[model samples]
Target: MSTEFHKLLFEISEALVTDELAALKFLSLDHVPRRKLEAIHEPKAFLEVLQEKDMIGAGNLFFLKELLYRIHRIDLLTAHLGSSREEMERELQVLGRAQVSAYRQLLYGIAEDLTSEDVRSVKFLLQKQLPKTKLQENASMLQVFLEMEINGIIKEDNLTMLKDILQRFRADIKKKIDAYEEKKKENYSREEVRYPVSVSVYPEEQGAEGEAAKQHGKIYKMKNNPHGYCLILNNHIFRNPRYNREGTLQDGEAVKRVFKWLQFETVEYMDLEGKKIYETIKEYSKKDHRNMDCFVCFIFSHGEKDKIKGVDDECVNIDDLVSCFTGTNCPSLAGKPKVFIIQACQGSVRHPSVAVESDCSGPLEVDASPLTSIPDKADILIGMATVEDYLSYRSRRTGSVYIQSLCEKMELLCPQREDLAAILTEVNNEVAKRELEGSKQMPKITSTLLKKLIFEVPQ
Candidate 1:
């Protein structure tokens, strides 16, 4: 065997003996797949199977399985690994006249029940099967088993992979400890510095015309005065009346009104045809890195979960756009919040509005693709207009029900409450009560905020 393979074998053996049981118990709790567990039997056997099938190493197959189990629990494991009575009989027949012991049967039963069992129960079972001596003696082989089990547990947790959780957890703990130590070492004499915040508003279609419409309406107005450095990317090309294809003229009108109510500094009305939006965001994120506290992108366009459509009918993945502001590229906003407000549809799942006397508003349609990936460390707040599969309504006279309600709530609730989440909750409640009445779609708010954010200018 090659050095890397040999190292793998050694690691696997160690995992099996020392930490395999603990890891397996965790996996069982998460509901890892049987196939994944089976692969951990022996590296030689695994290699042989691969060789026979003309395959390579397990790749990410085992890792993925473990990851699923961790997020979902043991129910998934039973569903994937449980064998029918007929299949069991076939296996017995293949084994010839040899009778299977009760212990062996119990072991199989436990394996099958791995998904249903709790972490403690799994640990007990694993301990019964592999004693400490066996684990310690064959530590290398055990490592592989442990790795497989760990993967399964993480899977049940609904994560991308086991390695990610492990790495993140370790990093987070270390960071916390470091922060604590640093705090302790520092003197309390220096005055704290208050970070300055910048807000940018991007109105699509209607240019200054949209801004004019907002002034006419009875709506909550955002202050036009620029607080700090801000860049607004507006789609001026769509402002023309000729672009109204549906004949409803609703979108164009809404854009115009929203622009009127909106406030920002240095507005750039560029055609978001190709990858202009992504490139623009990238360039802006890089500019004035030292003074910038964070980055915000408010996109008002027709969109799905992964993509947003431009005026000239171009598609851009939200991930590609957001990646530009990550810690690796834009270190200024590393620990700071990166807020992205998306006023679009996620998917096609709509929920009926319930008739209730209570003040709380029911959920609207579930957005098709809810945010799947938002880094734990980075603060990312995503506010969607309507739930999945439902149309976000816009009146000829008034603006979108959700947006109108949001602005109203921001004006009223933000001053009293400093927390952004609390403000959003009020917005949700208001939108639900006002916009969701007799309507099918409900507005939604999703966030991965690292710390409490004060929306109103902090006193």
Candidate 2:
């Protein structure tokens, strides 16, 4: 909004040529969506788009400086941004400062180093993967890389195909790929949450804490940067229109925000079928979770007594779902805490409210589902929205009573190092006092965890 800032951007935009503009756009492909970048032709227009995206503005021009530095525009950097090459280098070196992903930077760097002939050679090699229409003669290396990403030929996690193509003709460039992968692996390992895996109780663990930790006898290790994955399976629309679950999206959003704030790699799978839901769980179970400290799952859908119905109106047995993470099935998570939060009606009946004061009063809907009776597995905790054969309450405007309360309680108590069992007890107490449709909802927590599960608060 500053007039001086707009004048500075306008002057810088005047200095950039077409190719330099293309290069700037390529370098910024990670931060801005591809579809958005495709519409801009002039440098000033691109700068305006970046401004709209909050990528550049007054007192927030680091990304613009990075773009200029990458484009070898030191004159513009010095004159307009009042920054030098050395200053940008030092700032970028700080951990988590760069907005662009390292993976995208690698691809752009490779494209810049390649000649037109080299790009044609690369496109010829990718003939089998992408359609011929996308690999036309006028296609640039950046475009070819975009095609590879869109076609699943390459990704941040998997770059084998790109390396293979580069190694065939450009062995020198292939070496860069090797170095990048090695450095990435080192960084990932260093970033993982590290803690002792042994479950044996230590005196120091028990002696330092107050009544909360003493009550549980021992504490679960959650020393990793991201304790573990918090997978949310939200079924909003069912194949049978009448079974559509309203307000479940709110539940997923609430949990996602809380878990991400708690430093967990929160992922959500929306509107999955029964079979897909099982497969999703199995897929996660197969992943190597050695670097993680704990695993949490949230399932929001319709259900019967001991079964949850997917969007396809097909039911999955609650027992079978939990079985996917037994010690034998997911060895890496054996000693780590595994938590499941269920939001569904257990039965058709409603629990009678015998309260002195009514706390929960609002428009209510039901998620028409489990916990408890899990197999003999240690380090697993299950939180159910309601007791067996009882209906739980959810609001169309807000989320389900149990999940919202649980997220709030975690945000409040986890910072104080309160164990999860104690946190869920607080959720139980909170939800039990509320009256939804004149009926009380009591959340249930069934845990085989032998130790107190406490999350470390970020400083």
Q: Which candidate achieves the best TM-score against the true structure?
A: 2
lDDT of each: 0.44, 0.80
**Tens digit of per-residue lDDT, candidate 2, span 259-335:** 99889999999999998988788789768787898999999987677777788777788877887676645667876
Model 1 C-alpha RMSD to native: 19.1
Each prediction's TM-score versus the true structure: 0.43, 0.52
lDDT of 1 by residue, 29-129 (tens): 21334455455554344334432322223331222233223333334334433433344345434311112222222222333332322323333334544
Poorest stretch of ten by lDDT in candidate 2: 354-363
Best by lDDT: 2
Error of 1 at 50 (Å): 32
- The RMSD of every model to the true structure, in order and in angstroms, is 19.1, 14.0
